[model samples]
Target: MDPAKLSNAIENVHRAGMPGLFAEVRDGDEVWRGAAGVADLSTGRPVTADMRHRVGSITKTFTAAAVLHLVDGGEIGLDAPVGRYLPELVPGERGDAITVRMLINHTSGLGEYLPYAYPSLRAFPDLAECRPQSLDDHRLTRFDSTELIEMGVTAPAAGAPGGTPGLYSNTNYLLLGQLLERVTGVAAEKYITQNVIERAGLQDTEFPDGPQINGPHSRAYEAFFGMIDPPRDYSVFDMSYAGPSASLISTVADLNRFFGLLLAGEIVHPSSLARMQRTVPIVSQEGKVIEYGLGLYPMEAAGGGIFWGHGGTTWGAGALSMIRGDGGRRMSVAMNLQRWNTLDASGRPQPHPIDDALAALYRVAMSG
Candidate 1:
């Protein structure tokens, strides 16, 4: 691949007000790794490939793998009703019928009930409506997992038949996190760290206890719901605020390493990995796109190739991790700017540089 085109592409994305963009492509050896823009706009610290950004639901893949490992070991059964493992969280009648497999596949039909889904119900009303708070602020970093669970459990469900067959909810994974801990007798973070992260050797990656984003890294900011330009500072809004389902931080290189090992059958058993990727039909704007697999998403790429990976977006950060169908090549990108415009007729969004960056990165990586 031409280095000039790559540089130009990165430059264009940087100019669009993203704090920075970093990408790493792996093919037997790490290839074409680069970073651009400042980690902190105020301090003018240049972005580096090592700086961490939250990976969002990509963390789901790890959670799913942990559950499957237990399934493969005969400690848990995918077909067994979830109530057998977590009776408290599972409703009586519905609990007996819903299996663990349904939760991983988004076939559980549990409504997504994120407390942050509504701006009005926030725990700290003053902090809730504020645009983007600086990470340095004391009131913001105080957010933690306990508060997250409290808000989540009380939030309303998306539908009635809790585990019917067609809805995606973070609560399913949250429940999975709790179940994994129950079966293993270890916290979910430690279980995944020992079985997944440490096994894969991801040095810079971490799953903090709550939603804290304290580190020597880029300052995360977001484009508010109605705003166009990126806000000055959102550091005050920590991943700790979202807890496990949404709070994982990592770098492009670390993410690429983790996903590469995952698909290569290094961290998970082959049979279990196979079960994690099985697709199911679901309702969509179009007739029906593919529903989620275990922890990953199996989607058709812009260039007409099916890839397994996941994308995570918080208020400010956006993460993309993908492994080609063959699982031999992978590409990962992490950006600090979040843009919300819809893709045009060609499935392209120009003003939002992420769309272009994603397309070009996909083209080059998928070419192999």
Candidate 2:
């Protein structure tokens, strides 16, 4: 790999508006690591490759893998109704109709709970309402999992269970966390730690239960609902609101290791791995085409071929990890900024800087 070009790419990412960015790439037997910008804007702390950050929705990949481990062990069934495990939680006709596979693949039609629990710009689709002050009051609030699930369940379903045109809902994985607990007699975090994190030999990844990140890490920051305001430090906010759906904290190195093991069938059975890679096209609320599998996404590579992984974003952090389908290459990138996009005065959408950064990183990571 050309360090000069990679360094220039990092500089470009910094110029794009991220407070800081870090990336790790494994090309065959060699590994390349890079970072640019500040980890803490107030202190001007430089970001390092090993500094941890919230990996956000990438936690779903771990949750999915844990659930699949139960499936592989015959403790749970993919096609089985989630009602089989938590009949009371799901309950009645709706419960019986929704299957484990539907939840993992996001075909359960479950509505998201965040908007209902905390009305913020993230819940609103219009860019005009995405103001920084919208979420300022609830930054320190914590939510119970049961109440969060109830918020989603009481709302109308997104579509019929097992229906076509799947909608992405964090509620699906929230319930999956409940399902994992029901079957394993352990919390979702513990199960994933033993089965996925440890199995992947990841020392820097964890599902945190509190607002504090327990190790050396970059402070997370967000532009507050994508509004044009000074970025706020959100590194200490509670993640229980996200639970198993989006709260895993990790470094790029550990993320790349986890994806490498997952894609290589070391974390789950090959049959299960194959099922995890089976994908369906999803049209985002913004009308972009995304191919989603159980917990993985099939992103087009910079050069040619396909890579499988997931991207995650929280209030003030963002992460992306991907591996070649054939397991020849892998990369993980992270930034200490979220809601980085906003609308111009003309109502046109301004793209996030990470878009350009990832494009550059992908070119370098996927090169021969």
Candidate 3:
């Protein structure tokens, strides 16, 4: 397909009264990148390939790589109890039940909402106000892993150990982040920057400190309580609370390179990379049978190719990333608006418009 026509197809999505977006497709040595919508709609800034956006759970892929690096170094074992690294994590039911692999695979039977439950804690005027959380009340906002684990102990387990698979949970990755820090004797960000991001030659990506999107970024919009126009207040979507579960931010180009290098065995030892992609059964969100590998989600696309990547949703962001296993191609999309629960008048989540746009991009990438 001609790049111009492909670009027109992506831009026409917003023209169809859906939403404007920026996208990029890379093939072998050829790269076609373009942004066709208002990035910062508030100020009319146009989207660009370099514009940074929240990667949400896509950060897990990096964290998993770091853990596997330590494993390659013989510093940690996959089936070893997390208690071996962080003794504090061994409390109540989580004491002997959770292992390093279980945490990464979300088989640890931990609760899922300890991270997102903050938004439902107080009656908010809107999702935006709940996200950015005003400075005056900042002192009251803190999400500690210790407390999160304790909360999980009380909630009903998704299933018994090795019983059944569960969806993605921030608690799983948060524990993995702590375990990585413990074994490597380095901060998660530093280790990731040195081993993963820096090694990938991604000059445009950085781990952000909080919820706000800095530098050249997409126009972040919010769909709160199902209102389509915009969000009322976005004060509580603090990224700090997210920690390693979903704190990293990057551009589409950086994400593409990171995924490519990761799957190619450039980031970790060969055996470790093999272990990282090794998968087990996990429940599918769309009722499409799928498998959850170490940090990646392996799902069959409509085109009949198995793609490996992750989708992320934060306060006002919805993101999708995927790469074909054979190194044929890869695609990633990020939108500034998100609504996890609230639905449109026709009764659907607001982020679906952007999600569909991302799927379209994946289809084009696979067409090659």
Candidates in order, TM-scores: namely 0.83, 0.95, 0.85
What is candidate 2's TM-score against the reference?
A: 0.95
lDDT of 3 by residue, 123-161 (tens): 232333344333224423666765665555455666665
Show model 3 residue runs off by greater than 4 Å. 16-19, 115-142, 225-229, 232-237, 284-289, 340-357
Q: Sort by lDDT, best first: what order?
A: 2, 1, 3
Reference-based lDDT, residue 132, model 1? 31
**Which portions of model 1 show Cα errors greater than 4 Å?**
116-165, 210-215, 228-232, 236-238, 282-290, 302-304, 340-354
Per-residue error for 300 in candidate 1, Å, reads: 2.8
lDDT of 1 by residue, 237-340 (tens): 54554455667778888888888878878778988888778776544312245566777778666657778888887666778898877776677888876644
Pick by lDDT: 2 or 3, better one:
2
Q: Over all chains combined, what TM-score does candidate 3 have? A: 0.85
Q: Give Cα-based local distance difference scores for all models.
A: 0.68, 0.84, 0.68
The worst-scoring run of ten residues by lDDT in candidate 1 lies at 124-133
Cα error, residue 186 of model 3, in Å, equals 2.4
**Candidate 1 residue-wise lDDT at 320:** 87
The per-residue C-alpha lDDT of model 3 at residue 15 equals 59
lDDT (Cα, tens digit) per residue for candidate 2, span 98-205: 999999998888877777777654534555654555456776778889888988887778889988677888888899999988888999889889989998999989
